[model samples]
Target chain A: MLERLSDKWVTLVLTGLASGPRRYSDLSRRIAGVSQKMLTQTLRGLERDGLVRRTVTPSVPVRVDYELTPLGESLMPLVAAIKGWAEANIQTVEAARKTYDAA
Target chain B: MLERLSDKWVTLVLTGLASGPRRYSDLSRRIAGVSQKMLTQTLRGLERDGLVRRTVTPSVPVRVDYELTPLGESLMPLVAAIKGWAEANIQTVEAARKTYDAA
Candidate 1:
């Protein structure tokens, strides 16, 4: 569970869906650098975990959208906090790594 | 950064040190399933990230203790929340997975 939550792609995919439902292409574009296989796997994991819902719309071309389940939504504040901490402290962490490596 | 923060070993190690400094042996014992190599790696990663401090005491066996830095302490509430959420919702998640798999 921790592994799944901490996964980089999982973080990205959850964040992408936080605002609203998104098509796979939208997520693939928003999360830059995520491979198709990884995105699919992450979505599947999230769906299985009951944190995400996958909706399929039948049209000329089938449309699949992913959105957060209530459980997933409840987790957003925590996820956002983690993301905020990472963004704010990444520089400090990088400097620490450099200093540690030099020692 | 999210990956590091979300890591299962990282969570366990940080939680183990949440109260105060602990010896490697103590942490190894506290975090039941963690291997020695993984514990060492997690501690090193935390140290490098500036979230943990390692003190070496010159003793017969060179006593080593690990404690959270201010930054690490700051992260505890978040980690605690995640831990709480996981414990509370794990059964629900398991049920969801079982249902998903059966369908």
Candidate 2:
């Protein structure tokens, strides 16, 4: 569990999926620059862990959607909190870097 | 920054320092079971990122302390928020797992 939360790609994938279920391509697009291989691996991990629900729909073409299981959605606030914190404190962190560098 | 937050040890180390400055051993103890190597590496990374401040005090014996930089402390609410979210929703996550497993 800690290992899952600790990985960089996992959090990004989980948070991306938390927005709503998305297709493999949609997630690739939304996450910006994550390779297909990484996304596939990450989604597989989430699915295996039961945090993600992958559903495939039959249509003229095949459609697959990835949604947060209740477990996955449960993590949204934590992800948001981390994101919110970054939004709020990135400047502070940047300034500290400036100061530390100057010293 | 995203990479930093998404890393488990980094978040734990940040939150651990968020409470107050601590010695390496203190953090090792407080965090339950962090390896010395991992703790040292994580602290070094945080300091390199300027989110952590490491101070060495010379006494009959030397003492070293680590505390959040203002940047690191600023991250506390978010870390707390994550912990808070986890505490509130781990049960939901757990239940979802049971249901998913049963399916």
Candidate 3:
């Protein structure tokens, strides 16, 4: 369960969608290092979890966009908090690691 | 990195220590299904990351206790929110999974 949250791409993808809906190509472009396959899988998982809403608009070319649902939006602050904590403590953590390794 | 946050045991161990300090054995017991090796590794990682404080008491039989640091405590709310979100949406995710799988 928590494993899904840990997926390397999930956070980035969710954070990307937090701003607004993005087309598949746009999301793929925005999140660096995310491969097409992984993005698809991550989006599928989020969609399956009901955290992301997917819309397909038929046209000369089908336009598909991904956006966060309220459930997914609810996760934003938690995600942000976690990110903030990590950023704030990363230096300390690195120092501790060095000390621990030396000892 | 976010990967550490997603660690299967980190959340459980951090949550376990949030209330107060506990001996190694106590933590091992409190979080069911955590193997000795994994618990030890998790604690070492948390300790290295400066999230957990390890105290070794010199005695005929030395006792070691683990507790959360301020940094670790800061993570509690974020961790709790993640746990809460997962719990609240598990059923919906399951339902979505079924729908997704069927289509």
lDDT for each of the candidates?
A: 0.88, 0.77, 0.86
Per-residue lDDT of candidate 3, residues B4-101 (tens digit)? 67676998999999999999999999999999999999999899888899999997699999999887888788788887877887887788878888
Which regions of candidate 1 fall more than 4 Å away from where they truly are?
B33-35, B59-61
- In candidate 1, how many Å is residue B10 off? 2.5
lDDT of model 3 at position A73: 90
Pairs that collide in candidate 2 are none
Q: What is the lDDT of residue B50 in candidate 1?
A: 92
TM-score of each: 0.85, 0.68, 0.90
DockQ score of each predicted structure, in the order shown: 0.70, 0.36, 0.71
Candidate 1: true interface contacts recovered: 0.77
| Candidate 1 per-residue C-alpha lDDT over A1-103 given as tens digits, one digit per residue, 9 for 90 to 100 | 7677667788889989999999989999999899999999999999999999999999869999999999999888888777777788778889998999999
Error of 3 at B46 (Å): 1.2
lDDT of 3 at B92: 78
Ten residues in a row with the worst lDDT in model 3 chain B?
A: B1-10
Query: Model 2, range B39-88, lDDT digits (tens) per residue?
Result: 89888778877788899999768899998877667777766666676677
Which has the greatest lDDT?
1
Residue-level error in angstroms, candidate 3, position A87:
1.8
